[model samples]
Target: MITDPARLLVYESDGLTAYRTAPRAVVLPATTEEVVAVMKLLHAEGIPVVPRGAGTGLSGGALASPGAVILGTSRMNRILSLDPENRLARLQPGVVNTRLSDAARPHGLYYAPDPSSQTTCTIGGNVAENSGGPHCLKYGVTSRYVVGLTVVLADGEVVVLGGAGADPY
Candidate 1:
């Protein structure tokens, strides 16, 4: 991996024209195990984790703190499964918001919550921000479309938010 100060700065500063403090390092994990391992390392070292995708965040959520490790999920942008029958998709967090609709288009289905940055924003970021869009008034925000999530907690344990049962909210 090409890990350098300038590279990390570019990745962190993509969304904002003016930003501060690049990252100490950047990692692109391809699998759940890899991501969890990185998280565990950060936790052990007391280094902060900044989860990012597409760098489209208008706010500074993706911005890196000093010496923090920037975890860009862009490389993990893959649709694991799309079940039109179930009206859901098991997706990696880095998948673009609009990409879901594109993937769903073949089945005449679409993921709701088409944010203004749908083409650029990532699902994980949307989940974190509870991001809303123009159609949200009628449809709902990304929170509504999400039936479940595989979350990594602060302790570095992987947990599923929802199971085979219904939404279970």
Candidate 2:
């Protein structure tokens, strides 16, 4: 957790610099369990949580509200699994977008969503924004490539949505 005003300034705004709001604090959890615990505590106290990923969103979606805590996913970066044969990748929310393609390149595969900020933006942010670049006209957007999501609700309830083999309903 970051409470110092100086440190907090770094998270005051994302790529969209037009708007800025200093959060009460910032918490960067490094694991799923950690995120759940933080959410549980915040929920009990009635504090709002603003999820942020790499702070590169131009849509202003990552902006923190007054008295809210910035839940940054930057520390939870890792490629948990990459299955080239199955064309599936299990990654931590903080994994940078380009990193996924670089990893898959060895297997002659790549993550298709190529947002302009792909070099610095995290995949989680891309998912939230449904971001895309020039390639989207041909390959579609982020939602098309996303098959599953492990989400932690505001109340701290963890749920798995969709799956690798499940039909899109």
Candidate 3:
């Protein structure tokens, strides 16, 4: 069983302070295989699932339900790759918003979008809602940065969204 004294409560309320539930179990899977396995298990039981990142959500999107599986990706943070020539940075979904930009600082490049919760919001959640920021009008939103996504459905079916190229959708 997943354990973390405050995991449950934090799941319910991260970004939004008023509405919170915290979760019964909080899993931090470091790889795609682990994420798929847990999702498949939870899906088999037909349980509610809430995928979370930095817990800095303000829209109550990360709040947990009565009987839900809260998947926090904080532990999966990592920088997978970086291409200086192409001016691109590849990182895990759990990577922090500021972390990405911080890494890009010396390269004379940076992530275009800078949300208020950049310091705490995870890249996973940013991908979920296709986040936006003040510079999006010109720099574009999170959707522009994501070249692809490795997603696992409820039934343990893994799917790859987008591939290397110009099409990010």
On TM-score, the candidate that comes out on top is: 2
Model 1 per-residue lDDT tens digits across residues 1-169: 4377566557757466587667888888888888889899889989898887777767788888877888888888899988888776889989998888999999999878777788888898888778888888998777777777888765579998774455635
* Candidate 2 lDDT tens digits, 69-156: 9999999899999999989999989999999999999999998989888999998898899988899999888888888999999999
Q: What's the CA error at residue 33 for candidate 3, in Å?
A: 1.0
Extract clashing residue pairs from model 1.
none
Q: Sort the candidates on TM-score, descending order.
A: 2, 1, 3
The residue-by-residue lDDT of candidate 3 on 1-169, one tens digit each, is 4766653555668677987675768887888899889998988898877888887767888888887878878888998887767777767779998888888888887877778888888789888867878888988888888887778787889998775565654
Worst 10 residues of 3 by lDDT: 1-10
lDDT of 1: 0.80
Segments of candidate 1 deviating more than 4 angstroms: none
Answer with 2 or 3, whichever has the higher TM-score: 2
Q: Tell me how far the alpha carbon of residue 17 in candidate 1 is from the true structure, in angstroms, after superposition.
A: 3.1
Query: Which has the higher lDDT value, candidate number 1 or candidate number 3?
Result: 1
Could you tell me how far off, in angstroms, the CA of residue 118 lies in candidate 2 after the best superposition?
Answer: 0.7
Which candidate number would show the highest lDDT if scored against the true structure?
2
Deviation from native of the Cα of residue 150 in model 1, angstroms:
0.7
Per-model TM-score versus the true fold: 0.90, 0.97, 0.90
